[model samples]
Target: MIPNLDVDLLKTFLAIADTGNFTRAAEEVHKTQSAVSMQMKRLEELVGRPLFTRDGRQSRFTADGERLIEYARRIVNLNDEAVAAFTKPELTGTLRFGTPDDYADRFLPEILARFSRTHPLVTVNVDCAMSPVLYERSRHGELDLALVTACSEIIADEIVRTENLVWVTSQRHSAHMLDTLPVALSHTGCEWRALAVGALERQGRKYRIAYSSPNSNAVNAAVLAGLAVGAIPEICLRPGMRLLSEKDGFPKLSQFRIGIVHRPGRRSSAAEALSRHISESISNMPRQLMAAE
Candidate 1:
């Protein structure tokens, strides 16, 4: 008889995968570190394959472990869905959700679709703006929940994802090769703009802000049109954009974080449900960014 995999074990396994550390996974799952290890061992035995291999002090997923992530997420999600459907009251309410324009373009569609399917009666009103604007709205209680890029100036309730910030230019253009680089970026006070300009300054590369806008779509359009080079999170990269690297005389930029913040006090069922969907959807995204060849 085939052994049935335990949902509890799978949850613990997913925590480890999401956190990438046994200690952190234990904290997430509310289990002792040793207990988390034993749970992983049991899971491996059930599957009859080693799930993780140690690299120095860190534990990395093996090929089978990587492959099982999708199956585990689906299984756990379905289990939760069944339990929620039977045990909980149907959620119904209007939720005010805010996010930066760039994040909305890349992540909102999947998050909203999955959430609507689970809570059909919940209405999500999306507001797209700059991160600072969203942060202010969330703090003012005007938005129920906001997803923003984490920056030093604002404190986020929870960080859901992190990725490299890369320089991009049009595939057909030589904008990066220009003597005085032309940059397309968000308006003043944007963290991405600051980072990009600072990096260029440190490299002693002369650059001018050729295009500036609060809208990510406009910035991307300038880059795609080969009018200027722009910096964006790896996940936000478009199909026609080419990455610039140190070899291209571009300095490396640091990783940026995506975080979610909720209004203070009690959260409505709709807000709670959407928050869970956002966290799960983002945490399950591919962690590795595409490298410049």
Candidate 2:
């Protein structure tokens, strides 16, 4: 036996099956009730079967309709899956994601957690390093996507999130000591380090690196010990640390424009979902992040 059926008819049938009411199914499909009734009649005539038993405006699928609903769901899902696999972009291989040091702690878990929930089958490989290092790697295709600093070069096709840079010193330290270099920072390639150093250079203020480490926690620890003034995200400053504001001639660390970057091509559903989650999470950062100084 041959069945002549259109995809739209099947979609209508599915909607009717789920909603269990002609009026509701018509609304679900954005069709007028009369139009839906006509289509259902046409579909039933073509299949030589009464798909639903109707009592006034209410309807219930017949035994054959129950069997057909399962097949319809499979057929529709498979058709969509096939189109996505071939016509759309297929992204099933291992996805390498790069991220800077502190963001891994601050953001990756939420991003990856949602990503894994959505795409449980895809493998996510995270490469965490300093920002400049990851940016270079992403440029070379070593990583498919990265959380990177948004300098002019990478601004296009980037997802930008703004954060302020503040000087954090141990609460025990006197505010006057800020004149001296109080904290060490990451090595030469770090974005925060560049901002901090550049601001000092512009101010013509002489300062020394009290302690330098690639690890942000290490820098925080140094500041906690009153070894030096560490520049940190206003969000990340520990409770015991004092964030110096403009009254202190605030060494003017520029704001960080951070975002995700990828190669110039279509992204996988998994990657797109991850990127969206990251954008949402960062944009809607907790009030703690922008708390008043």
Candidate 3:
């Protein structure tokens, strides 16, 4: 007979793989680094394959690890759906979740991994798009829950997370040129782009879109090259990047609301479970940022 695999252990493995850093992964799962390492050791022993390749300094997913993550996501999601459907929870159908593209690179993966832990049986379909598109989809029933950023006027049924908006620039650039140069932003429908543009207009400053990319990484690349100044989450601006202060002539942008909107009315158990996990994940890493300089 095949040995039984522990679902909780699998969840921990997935977190480690997603973050690629033991410390960060540990924080997500509420475990100590040493405790997480031990869990991985046990999981590898039980699976009978090496899941990760740890070079002296970095950890990488093995081919097996990659395959396992795919299966793990499905397993975790499906399990949650089962608990919701048959048991006291009762949420079996697929959960189509949407989020703004800005979160795609930074937070989505981690959030998904955490959500999967509870709803191991539900299928989670994720859509990353502009806030308007996501909101429209949720309204149309195409999405069960959506995490988006929007102006105060676009109120939602639920507000999930809120974050500080700050100006980001390359450390190599001087502060005086902030308002003079063009800025990098996303396509027009994006909430962040709108906020950035609104702030500039309110200050009576003249600027242009020096560059715009559909992908956040592309925009980050433009700013990294000293191409232009852009507004980004305060959490995302790390030690190696420059934050424009009041002295720099760039006014502090107001905090943006990152809300989680779900279909109005009562929610199914599976949906609630997924939402709870996401909230937990977000809460755990309240202001965690990347140092990708």
Candidate 2 Cα errors over 4 Å, as ranges: 1-93, 175-179, 289-293
**How well does candidate 3 score on lDDT at residue 185?**
88
Better of 1 and 2 by lDDT: 1
In terms of lDDT, the best-performing candidate is 1
Compare the candidates by TM-score and give the number of the best one.
1
**Per-residue lDDT of candidate 3, residues 1-293 (tens digit):** 67777888888987886777788999999999999989988988888999889788888888987777766765765666466445653345788888766676667787777555545568888888778888888877778888777566556775666788888888886533854757988887767787889988988888889888767777777787788887888756644468877887787788887667787667777677777766645544535333234
Per-residue lDDT of model 1, residues 58-154, tens digit only? 8999999998988898889878877776687789888999999888987888898878777888888999999999999999999999999888987
Candidate 1: which pairs clash? none
Question: What does the lDDT read for residue 83 in candidate 3?
Answer: 67
Candidate 3's displacement at residue 286, Å, is: 3.0
Ranking by TM-score: 1, 3, 2
Which should have the higher lDDT, number 2 or number 3? 3
Model 3 misplaced regions, further than 4 Å: 1-92, 173-179, 238-240, 264-266, 288-293
- Candidate 2's clash total is 5
Superposition error at 6 for model 2 (Å): 36
Measured over all alpha carbons after superposition, the RMSD of each candidate to the real structure, in angstroms, is 3.4, 14.5, 10.3
